[model samples]
Target chain A: MHIVVCIKQVPDSAQIRVHPVTNTIMRQGVPTIINPYDLFALEEALRLRDKMGGKVTVLTMGPPMADESLRKALGLGADAAVLLTDRFFAGSDTLATSYALAAGIRKIGEEEPVDIVFTGKQTIDGDTAQVGPGIAKRLGLNQLTYVAAIRSLDLENRSIVVERRAEGGVQVLSTGLPCLITMLEGTNTLRRGAMDDMFRASRATIATWSAQQAGVDDIALCGLRGSPTVVKKVFAPQPRKEKAKMVETAGKSDAEIAQATLDTLFSANPKLETDLRKLAAAS
Target chain B: AKKELSEHFKTYKDVWVFIEMERGKVHTVSWELLGEGRKLADKLGVQLAAVILGPPGNDLKQAISDAWSYGADLAYVVSEPLLKDYRNEPYSKALTDLVNTHKPEILLLGASTLGRDLAGSVATTLKTGLTADCTELAIDDDRCLAATRPTFGGTLLCTIFTLNFRPQMATIRPRVMAMPERRDAKPGRVIEFKLSMVEDDIVTKILDFVPDTSTEEAHLAYADIVVAGGLGMGNPGNFRLITDLAAVLGAEYGGSRPTIQKGWISADRQIGQTGKTIRPKLYIAAGISGAIQHRVGVEGADMILAINTDANAPIFEFAHYGLVGDATRILPALTKAFEARLAVRRMAS
Candidate 1:
């Protein structure tokens, strides 16, 4: 089995801060990490490869710096890494990004047939959750999203079953091979790389591909020109006129403070007190 | 350039909301989008149309009526056995065909699992742009759909426009928009479409569905009130304080993303941008520092009461009320206070 796991390098959202006056993201000193969700996809791919005796290739589409993320995935036991990067791919939205990645996956398939493609449920920076399905649509692959577990895999039959997270329940789905799966976060823990793997990854050369090399026929479809959506404006959420009113707590016990807070809360919103009272009575 | 692109899509009219239904029940987010779609439709002076694709049944009929009551002016219905179960192949085909035949200026869908699954495929098939998890939707001065959504883990908001794409598409999460009042309205005209796809066309098959029987499943999004904890709760064992407080108020209990990472709570109960976006009437955040991710999820709540040991926690900036104290100490006290207050109110009633 040949599995291609798609990963992305995104700025650590937790550490990102907006400029107070300019009201824009301060990306200057922010650090970039492998999108945390993608780690789960890589680990799941590694586990599948280990069990089924196959090769796992990690793939990413980003700037040249994204090679670091691919190397990190190799350290985690992936057999190979591919970086699809080019100047023409900048400003690609989810649709355009998926188009580039799909082309890269097709090029990879020329050497060895890929049985499965894996991606995280969504990227942290975009958080759109559209790329996996987008890729599947472009490549004509069965799209299985929000997969919590791989229940069974019949290699001979080219069949796979997975437990998919749904709105109110879990759906056990069966699909053919050559499918795309978006692994949900927290489903599995990433493994620590062994000494040998770490050394191999540090020295492993990542294969880089431009849009043309990746078999993208149309340059217009690879970047801003291909993107249908345009970002009109970006700004910080407007701050409320007043900060949270603090309940007095100078030498006051927790109970007293709670009572005082409730009093103030009720006085400010008289309907809230009545609603709560009614709910309590019903409960 | 903008005018040329707009001219190409001039044939597309009206605003369409995808009404998602499964197993005879329509997802509430569908109605929520219709409510929001109504505003955009009115702003653009276009009709609000609900798109329904399902097996022919009373549920489908009821959804049509409900859409009308929720402000839809008309509906497009495709009743096919293949669409009974939402296999992305047929649903996307049905939706894309509808958009192609009768183009719409704007299309909205709920950001639920099913909606996301179908939207991505339909958008890709049609070569259109789709914005996901939009917090706000409106028609801009340019007569284009302005889809505003949180970006970079909700630290900033960005408004997106499908400049050249006809049927500019967007998906909004559950509870993000207010539920519009359902009024008695005359049922609107329904346009029926046929999905020519067959069973052999679908690649994925549903073997079985196991409904959530575990009581631990968190319905945080629709909860009337929510109480959540964070790393400041100190340890996993202290999460019970949040649950205890929730029990008194008949509210759901959740945790911040850090707590989920720590295994202090299940991932489903995580309340943040990466987790669930809730708009409860009352949100009590204990020990949480209110990262942008968490703030975006809970900022929709009618009232937010933040309790933390640090008075300067970022949570205090947007919280409606703040109590500066150890959550371990304050949670229990607050629980008791609520219990006593409710008991008194119950007795008085």
Candidate 2:
């Protein structure tokens, strides 16, 4: 049971603030971290490897700096790391991205048959959960998204069951092995790397693969040339100019403060009380 | 049609909206998409069709009629017992089969769990581009679907074009579009299709369903009143301030994306672009900075009241009501006030 986990290094979106006057993204001084969601996938893969006695290879397609993320995954007990970076692969959308990743996974499988490919539900930057399905379609692998938990695995029979989060309920789905699974967030806590594992990770040699080396036979299908969707424009959201009406509560007692705010709330929206009363009565 | 589109795609006509249903109940987002799809159909001077795949019963017929009332000119129905519950393999195959058999120029779906799951697989299976979570959809001069969505962590908006694809497909997030007016309950042309595949063909089998029973299940999407906390809440202990206020007002409690990432709240309770898009009558955001990510989710709230110590917080710019004070103190004050007011009503009544 060999597993490949796809991870990306993204700028911490929480710290990213837009310049008020310019309405431009302020990326300076914002540190890059492995996509927070990807950690759950990486951890899930490592846990599977631990239980099944297989190797977990962490893979990423990004700039040279993305090696830092692969190294971080290695520190967390991934058996191997591969970085797919090349100038030609730049500007790839989800389609080209899935193409490159499928090629990379195929090349890895040429050495050892890959059983499961894992990725986060979606990348923070892209927020498009298309890549996993795209890759699955390209590679003809069974794809499962938003998996909350891995229930059972029978490597011999090549069967697995997972709890997938659906809209109103959870679907306990059973699928065959050699499928691609996108782990949902908050399913498990990422384990901290031990001292021995940290030392081993530092000494591990990260495999470097260019577009050609990653089994990308047609370079045209690997980057911007392959992407069908085109972005027409990129602009900041227009801000609303209306400021909120402030409720005064300066130096007032708790009871008075509550009374004043309630007064303003009821006065401004005269029907609010009626609506709440209706809801209360019905419930 | 763009000049780049091959002659093979020229024959693709009409706009189709996938009508989503579960447990014999139609999801409201499906109607929203149908409403949106009707406009694109009108713009292209083509027919607006609703595609329904479900079990064989009156539920499917009612769904088609609902779609017709929502301005659809036609309805495509594929009824089968196997299609009762949404399994990606069967649903995607059934949808892909429908698209290939009857080529529609554009396909629209609601960005619900079922829609997202089915859209990705169907689009991939058809080898076409799919834009997800679109905020806007319009037919371009060239007849391309201009799907616009917030990108780069919601800092900017990007309009994507599937220029060469036969059926330009997109999934619009719920609450982003206005529900269209229902025409005088007219019946549309119904085209019924067949599900050729059997149950054994699907590799994935549904074993059991466990409905969400956690106390933290914040029904934020449909809540009339929502109270959300942010990083300003200080810590996990202070989250009680939000829940306490919500309990008093019978409102739902949620948090910003940061609180979810920080593990202060569950992911379901997070309100933002990546989380849940909530449209409540009143949304009270405590100590929220109102980033574009969070703004997209709460902007639909009928009235937003924001409380933050920083008067310069972006939330104030959009909030219907604003206050400059520590939420730690303000939250408790508001809670006490609401409780007192409601308690008095209970006694008087």
Candidate 3:
């Protein structure tokens, strides 16, 4: 079984800050890491590969610097890594992105048949969660998204069962092999790489593919020109009129301060006190 | 004020909202989108329509009627056995067929798991643009759909427009918009469509469905009051203080993303841009630094109270009230205060 896991290199969103005066994202000092959601997908792929005796190849579409993320995936026991990078791929939206990635996957499939494809539930930067399904549609593969767990897999029968998270319930779905899955976050933890694997990752040569090398025949569908959605404008959300009103607690005990705070809250919205009483009583 | 439309997009009209239903109950986000779609349709001088796809049953009929009552001027429904449960293949094919035949200018769907799965496939098949998790939607000066969504993890908001696409599509999370007031409106027109594909064409099959039986599931999005903690809560043991305070107020409890990463709280109970968006009457955030991601999720609350030891935490910038102290101590104190106050009320009543 050849399993391909698609990952993305995204800015560490936790450390990202907006400029107070300009209202622009401060991307200069923000460090980049593998998108957190994708790690779960990669780990699940590695585990499946370990059990089923197969290969796991990490795939990413980004600038040249994304090679670091691919290397990190290799260090975590992936067999190989592919970086799909090109100047024409800049400003690609989810639709254009999935198109290029699908082309690359097709190229990979030509080398060796891919039985399964994995991606994160969503990326932190875009938070769109569209590309996974987009790739599935383009490739005509069965799409299973938001998968919480893989219950069973039969290689001879070429069937897999997964527990997919739906609204308020979990759907146990069975599908044929060569399907695409977007793994949910918090489903699995990434394993620590061995020292030898880390050393190998440092020296491994990643296969870098341009748009053409990835079998993208249509240049029109490669970048900004191919994207249908246009960003008309970007700005910061309007700040509230005033900062939080501090409850003075310098000399007061914790209990006293708590009572004072409740008094202030109730006084500000008189109906809230009665509402809270009813809610508390019911509970 | 409308701009000249291209020849390809000239015939596309009306704003469509996909009414999502599962287990015989319609998701509330469908009605919220209908409420929003009405405003956009009225602005563009077009009709508001709801698109429903499911098996033929009373549940589907109720959804159609509810769509009209909520604000849909008309509804397009496709009922077939293949659509009984939301398998991507049949649902996307049915929806895509309807969109092709009707040619809607704008399509809105909830950003739920099923909706996202269907929307992505349908939009890709149609080769159109889809913006996910849009916070705001409006008719622009040129009469295009302007979908505003948080980007770069809620630090900035970008307005996206699908100019060349005939059917502009977008998804919004549940509770992001106010629930529309249901009214006694006349039943809208229903246009029924037929699915030509059979079950054999589908590859994926549903083996079983496990409904969430745990009564303790977090209903954070629709909670009246909410209490959340962050890494500053120190450890998983201290995270219980949030639950304790919430219990006293009869509020739902959640945590920041970091807390979820640390296993202090379940992923479903995470309150941030990538988690759940909540709009409660009152939201009390404890020990959270209030990153923009977390701020956007809870900013819709009517009142926000932030408690932290750091007086300069970003949460205080927008929170309605601030308590500069350790949440470990303040949470228990607040819990006691509420408990006593409620006991006094209970005795009086």
The candidate that achieves the highest DockQ relative to the unseen native structure: 1
Q: How would you class the docking of model 3?
A: medium
DockQ of each: 0.75, 0.57, 0.70
lDDT of 3 by residue, B304-325 (tens): 9999999999999999999999
Candidate 3 TM-score restricted to chain A: 0.94
Ten contiguous residues with the weakest lDDT in model 3 chain B: B1-10
The stretch of ten residues in a row with the least summed lDDT in candidate 2 chain A is A274-283
Misplaced by over 4 Å in model 3 are: A19-24, B1-4, B343-349
Clashes per model (N, Cα, C within 3 A): 0, 1, 0
lDDT of the candidates, in the order given: 0.90, 0.86, 0.92
Q: What residue pairs are clashing in model 3?
A: none
Per-prediction TM-score: 0.97, 0.92, 0.96
RMSD of each: 1.6, 2.8, 2.1
lDDT tens digits, residue span A1-283, model 1: 9999999999998788888887778988889999998999999999998998989999999999999999989998999999999999999998999999999999999999999999999998999999999999999999899999999989999999999988778999999998999999878988999889989999999999999999998899988888998987889888777899998989998889888888878888888877787666665
Rank order by TM-score, top first? Answer: 1, 3, 2
